[model samples]
Target: MGIPKWMTGKILCKTGADLVNATDPELVKFIGEIYYGLFRGGKIRQCGLGGRRSKFTIFPHMVKKLNTGLHVMIIIFLCVAIFFSLVSFGFCILNAIKVPYRAINGPAGACLWNFLAGGFVVLAVTSFMAAVKLHQLTERIANFRENIFRFVILEERFEDCFWICVASATAHAVNLLLIAISGIHFPKIKTKTEEVNVTAEDIMY
Candidate 1:
């Protein structure tokens, strides 16, 4: 019934008069600070977005901590999704190249090559999808030239790299999963066990 906490928390002005009287620089600063705070505050919660109101009993710091965790999860998931997608893409592409289309002289070889090509196409799609999700997860707030943290980091080129890496990493996870399901196993380490060897000289005398 009341305005959402995220909405209220984002308020930089209490009155219309204040907004109208504010200078351009002042307004920009206020808006920037609010965005910066929101970024630091973590992912906005469902309660903050207009669900059952957050319990009044919870302390502000606790709420902030919870939000921070939520944000971190979002980031971590996006990174993972991207990583998997790219892996899938790479496997598909590499396999597809193993048998060139022009070199395929028989139906069986051609069929296998087609299958690999199909896998490559599927993985490319997965990678593209992961990129889309990553873009949404970051809320597209990150910009290449603009520094979101302002004074902390110098140009924020990392933001651009992060987005690129995430997109590139997306679908390879499926390739790994398929390999696992196919029963292909990686080498396992063997541990040495020490057992006492009994000799005739040690016959329980």
Candidate 2:
């Protein structure tokens, strides 16, 4: 999902520099405050000294500054998660309306899709966190397209949008648990048995 336009306060990471420590006046001008929100497409606000403020979207504006590969991976995983969640919902509706095939009867189909969705959600969150921590995402975003001044990360934290994904993952887990608690056993693998000739003589022996 994309970031909401109204969610300006849902900052994912915040970065600031010590203006007093800057010896260069031009550098001090660029050193104020910056924060990035959850989605890359969301609005990122950069405030400089003397109340000079500029706003830009993170996707097209800061794409060059981010770890493009990891960022793309996170997006792909999120899309997949959404797809699987919808598939699970469809399965739930199917179960309520009609009798399904043996392979997907009861909670089995829903559970499978939920598991996949939860897995992808976990992957997305983990990859995003890795990109943020290992690649210094906030600092990169804060300093995007700037040649004169660089911003160091002063403070950073996961915000509401990140937690929303976490909550979705938790909901998937709870759904699976509820399915189990309802006494519906997950489908088990069945092995094929070879037919053998039975003789009365063997039994007598």
Candidate 3:
């Protein structure tokens, strides 16, 4: 999420009549091409000004400026989610290619892994939302390393990358439904049996 070009235009127009005959070359150039922050995946890129392309990652680069603990939590949850998703994928391939132990390769196992992945994805999303909304993440990122110009957020929205995470969560949920539809039985239900009691006298006889 980042500031839009229209927002920059609005801000420049708000600077009064001087904008019409701005003598400062820098100010004129800035009006022509304003700076905007764009967040994509793990990195933030500076765009829309003087062909200046500056990029940096969330880790190490901007960690000091962000809620480090919350950021780390988000990363950890995402990593765990990816691991579980991979495990589920491998289990699916195994189920298709060869017979495997029920504990590891059945619909139940798939459901378990999918559930775990979905849970972590939810955690990651929630944590990131908190970091962004409650903590002013985009504003913080936009202001990072700026010595002169200050960037104020005019509008912010989740970009495609963020929605992709949402889509992944949705996919995991759909996988759970598909696994259930595949006729999954609880382990206890599958192993249930009637028990017979034999008395000592019957045994002796």
Best by TM-score: 2
Cα lDDT tens digits for candidate 3, 1-205 = 2322111211122132243444544443432222322222221322224434445555567788888899788778888999999999999999889886797688789889999999998998888888878998766766667675555555566655557778999999999998777685656646668898999998999
Residue 37 lDDT in model 3? 24
Please report the TM-score between candidate 1 and the true structure.
0.26
Model 2, runs deviating above 4 Å? 4-31, 37-48, 184-205
Cα-based TM-score, every candidate: 0.26, 0.71, 0.64
lDDT of 1 by residue, 168-200 (tens): 333333434454565556688999999999988
Can you give the lDDT of residue 129 in candidate 1?
40
Q: What is the TM-score (0 to 1) of candidate 2? A: 0.71
User: Which whole-number lDDT from 0 to 100 does residue 134 have in model 3?
Assistant: 97
Model-by-model lDDT, in order?
0.35, 0.68, 0.65
Give me the overall lDDT of model 1.
0.35
How many residue-pair clashes does candidate 1 contain?
A: 15
Compute the lDDT for candidate 3: 0.65
